[model samples]
Target: MASTEAPEVLRYAAFTGDPAGGNPAGVVLDATGLDASRMLALAAEVGYSETAFITGRDEARRRFSVRYFSPLAEVAFCGHATLATSVALAERIGTGALLFDTPAGEIGVDTVTGPDGKVRATLTSVPTRSRPAEAIEVDATLAALRWAAADLDPDLPPHVSFAGNDHLVLAAASRARLADLAYDFDALTAVMRTHGWTTVHLVWRESEGSYHARDPFPVGGVVEDPATGAAAAAFGGYLRTLGLVTAPRTVAVRQGEDMGRPSDLTVEVDPYETRVRVTGQAVPIP
Candidate 1:
């Protein structure tokens, strides 16, 4: 049985200090009485890319069991929502380290208040893996996106990357190509569903260690994600797996510029570790 009463929902924008500058997410601090159906309904009503629900907590371990729901379905993991939820909890419990047991795996997060009085959260993702995209996968995705092989960057080959969730990595030959995003939503959704991919990580390199990115999230019931932490994490893994960057490298990803809601994400990759670290700032939406 689920509670009939409405649960409190908090809105926050992740990856940016400004409320209107990043991806928004709904957070339910205590979803004790909410069932899956209720959570899904609430998520759909909120209509964000994803919503996070904290179902259980272990005070002594500083751990909590969290679940992520999109407007259409439950996802294995959601990075932006995790960052927003961590900041929300830090506001109440003070900034510190926290562990989240998600459906994907255990994720460790650390929150700190900077001298500027902004709360920044860094999340260490689960073990990541990547492999070259199959020829069939690339052909189908290209058709769905209406992109010709010539439009893709030869430097960065297509690959399927995973941190917590899978993302198909595709690099456009030029920034202009990345900016002009118009695709068959249903067709792309079908392609993603076939590969169990969460999003298509479309990116173009700006400079050394800097890139512009866009994500199409039709499966999540969103046309585009202003900022995508999960995909950013996977992108880091992809870069490392392909030897595109040296070890102990940090990449700066700028997204949502085309949508007019700018977001900045920092991804750190280490030579010895398999997990990727994604750091961003989140602010409450008032």
Candidate 2:
């Protein structure tokens, strides 16, 4: 029998004002009693891309310990969940700074009213890093996606990037290449598991500080993610690592359009700093 007492879950879609757009996330403001199994079950029931549970809190510092769950597993960190959680907290406690002690590291976020009069949240990730993807791994990944090396963008090289979680970043030469996203789910899942990757951040850069993105989350039992915070952070790091963009700059990411759930992300890179900041607005999903 299922437990009668379950924590109430708040639903929010991050990165979009419209409830029907963005990535849906389950936000549990207080999860003191929820265990791993319970959280996972709740996530499965919610059927969102991911769910965030706030376990511990410090009123003085406005800090909390947050855990993230997908239907099948726990992730070290999640961008969408963090954004959702921050907005949820802001609604209750009012807009301010919130610190999160995530599995990956301590992250700081700020919630403030936007010019449009809506509450928006921004999270500054831990130090970001990136490395060249191994040739063998790249080959395997391409095989799983049924993509050829020639299809890759010469300007944007492939790399394994990390801000909170690791992501394989690949830039498509054209928007068409990015739009046609057919891949072997099982094969990609196997490769992602072996590589300890959370998602594959496929992108087509439109211009400096603007790009379209798609995330393949086979490892999490999802074909594609409408919006991915972690990947955005990592991709910001990738830009910095490659000197693709000047620091102290903000970049815009448009994702989930192909899936019909559009999302927007703002990534800020500080000069001489490794941490990347991602900001977005989340609204309740009726």
Candidate 3:
């Protein structure tokens, strides 16, 4: 039997240039004839948190229609995968703006080489919205995570924010709390399923502009996300909604260190808008 897939898929690590760091995502740059089942199969074969499939393209406009699949199901939008895909395209097509027609909305990405000679990319998210988390929902989440009320940061209240997907924003009281991430995966999965949550954004604020984050994504069949660009974008909106930070500032969210895959994401927010801009560089994972 021969595989009919064309334009061989590429592997890249997003949020960090180091091959060993960042979250790995499979990129099918040209998924001309690939269907939903085939894409999911490919993603499972790749065994990454997610895989990005570019179904349609406009060479003249440098635009593409992208779909994301996890090992289990499809995703509305995936920031790390988008970054990985942009980096892959930039490596071959040269750095510039690329448009993506995603399930969530149309997104614009710009790729550029930093002063250090790394190919970095920035993605602008769709309009974001945040609402207070219901008491029962928050309580169940805290219990599933094995965290207590004292473990939460008093300054940052519990909220559910959405950019491309829904995520529960939980602020831990200390870095130590965020570091120890032994949670009940099944319990969390059940809670998330009930609430339609993609990830729980566990965070510890190091400073006004610096933060540490971990995402438990049991619903995706992953214990934790190495780097979560979508959650970073949502967190930016969360901060804005809560009046936690001044707008038009860049906040750094560090993740994957505890998992031994240190990743960095820069989230920018403007005072007047609800969209968040996330930036990071990716490298091919050979």
Candidate 3 accuracy as TM-score:
0.97
TM-score of each: 0.98, 0.97, 0.97
Residue 173 local lDDT, model 3: 99
Residues 1-286 of candidate 1 have per-residue lDDT tens digits of 7888998999999999899899999999999789999999999999999999999998677899999999999999999999999999999888999999999999999999988898999999999889999999999999999999999999999999999999999999999999989999999999999999999999999986999999999999999999999999999999889887676989999999999889999999985778999999999999
Clash tally for model 3: 0
Estimate, for each residue in 1-286, the C-alpha lDDT of model 2 and write its tens digit. 3344888899999999889999999999888887888989898898787999998999788999999998889998999999999999998889999999999999999999989877899999989999989998899999999999999998999999999899999999999999999999999999999999999999999998799999999887789999999999999999999987664899999999999999999999875889999999999989
Better of 1 and 2 by TM-score: 1
* True-structure lDDT of candidate 1: 0.94
Off by over 4 Å in 1: none
**TM-score: model 2 vs. ground truth:** 0.97
Error of 1 at 32 (Å): 1.4
Give the worst 10-residue stretch by lDDT in candidate 3: 1-10
